[model samples]
Target: MIDDAIRVLAGDCTVIAEDADRSEYRGRVTTIVKPDNTVLVHDIDGYQPVAWLTRADSVSSDRTGDFTLVAKKDTQTLRIAAHDQDGFAHYPTSAAGTPVGDCPDCGGALVRSSGVTCVSCGDRYGVPADATIRDDQCDCDCGLPKMRVERGLAFNVCLDRACESLDAAVKQAFDREWGCPEPDCDGDLRILRRGGLIAGCEHYPDCEVGFAVPAGVVDGECACGLPTFETGSGIRCLDATCDRALEGALETEPTADD
Candidate 1:
């Protein structure tokens, strides 16, 4: 996750914005320095910012006495000098989204921003791309939110990997359960995570047989001796391109795009 802290300086500040033309703004304004170094100077006049610089390549601040913040991007620059600094602070922030639960480490609001994140403490939990954050909290001592993930079956597991690992659950349920579909390879399909969940050959480097676990539940066995997953697209073989499943299984009409 990127930095979730935002620097704020509010007071009677003189703002200088340089772009296609030079302009200066002076008032009791609020200067917001975003996590990505974007600077926004907002006055009491309107909802729109008086002056701003987009995500800058460089940002420098001097708070010796009167606070000074300068952000530069390409050829544009936004400078703020607070002559009478009223308040200056760095606040932990997160995107406003559906609240999952409260953070166990810090009593902060946990939200779905990129992943499950603590709005106050900045603690983050990686969730499966297809998983849904459930309202039902985990029973474990960690007190993290449970996520509904579908690998073979719908699994309700804790978001924190240390408390309840999704990989370990899947591995316990399905590891070495399938035989390798590769010709003459006496290897068992093993559950593993390499960026994403995958069922790879136990003989990894030698066999090089790996298939990404689709976001679906296992419905039946494929003619190719692999699992047939009931996915959003319909029924599909674990090996996406298995011709045997296509030949024997019921075919669904291609979904029309809206």
Candidate 2:
């Protein structure tokens, strides 16, 4: 899906456009919602649900604040915003586009001339080829990952300090399971992914467990017969050859450490 996700500077209160008829907001300038086309918002509830606004004006920490709009409909697109209130700025400020080099996506080394194909991923820039591209594999320095299998599978977790959006990851993990794994535990677990191989159980306040499901990567059919997800339990099989007694047997466990 084309994710129109944006990260604004994060602020207190924010709103987005819900429908074309913004009449309900005629005199309610405090609607806080934005127009359909979300302009740029900074230092408020950064783009999460996406609020469309026009030229935003007047920001106040006080509950009672006024904005500079000729009338409610005059700038109905404007949305009132606030920061996280956690005594910190937004994760990545939007004042200026981060430098490509400094950008986490671009990473450190932007230039690498090692091979034609991406040796690390084996993906050619445009087409698939036999030759190996050495550059971005292991930073321009770590080099391409060799075929030699390590002693144990390192946990699939990415321990990056910056990549800390764990909520969605955890939800995806639970979705992989489709529900809870513990037979006796009937309630249901909330999945939260920590960058590393293990994901945190959504029941953080209570049930704190870690898992190793690759969030959305459908591997294959579990021995049981159900389609196996990255870190899901056994597959659900109904084939005459399949067995439901032994947890269906189709469910595969983590073969490697991760």
Candidate 3:
């Protein structure tokens, strides 16, 4: 979640910025304090900000008499002192994208950015990269949108991963379903979250065989003993780099003469 944007609008402010160098200006400007604590002072000047402090370590403001804002990073500092203030307020903002649904917590409009995010409340739900967000809503109390995520199969999961975890669904569907491809290894492949989603060997320390879950639904078993996935490109083995499996799959395909 992110904090709301704070703005000082239509004000005669003096800006002093210092890092490796020092610069100062005094004019009617607008100051924007972004959610990430980055301060931007805008004047009649072109596209770029007149003075800015990017993701400052500390940001302090005093609107008692004159609206004074000071933001500092490691070695950089940006200061703004307003002589005549017009308005100061906080506004909610979110990344722009296609609308998904409403936030159950704040009743804000949820849109798909990198993930599903509420514009007003700043609530975020992480989704799988290959998952397709559906128009239908979830059946859970969270009231979040649903997504079609493909592991071994396409599953309709809640937008909020915590409410209905994609990993749990995948694990339930495919865990221990495939045998380890390693020779002389009687271990089964277990679906796990080792940094990322992967089908790893049961005997981990002894047998280091593991493959990243492909961004597709399982089609069939591969000649390499791994599962073949029907990806966007084509059918591919769980181990994407396995040329032998791909070659075997191609070789088994029936020709026009057959």
Tell me, by TM-score, which candidate is best.
3
- In model 2, which runs have C-alpha deviations exceeding 4 angstroms? 1-177, 195-200, 220-258
What clash count does candidate 2 reach?
27
Query: Per-residue lDDT for 100-177 in model 2, tens only?
Result: 122133223222233222222222122111212222332233232211111011112111212322234344444445
Q: Which sections of candidate 3 miss by over 4 Å?
A: 1-5, 104-107, 120-123, 140-142, 220-223, 233-235, 243-245, 253-258
Per-candidate Cα RMSD to the true structure, in Å, reads: 6.2, 17.9, 3.7
Q: How does candidate 2 fare on TM-score?
A: 0.23
**lDDT (CA) for every model shown?**
0.86, 0.32, 0.85
**Candidate 2 lDDT (Cα, whole model)?**
0.32
lDDT of 3: 0.85
- The candidate, 1 or 3, that scores higher on TM-score is 3
Residue 18 deviation, candidate 3, in Å? 1.6
In Å, residue 194's CA in model 2 sits off its true spot by: 3.8
Please report how far candidate 3 places residue 6 from its true position, in Å. 2.9
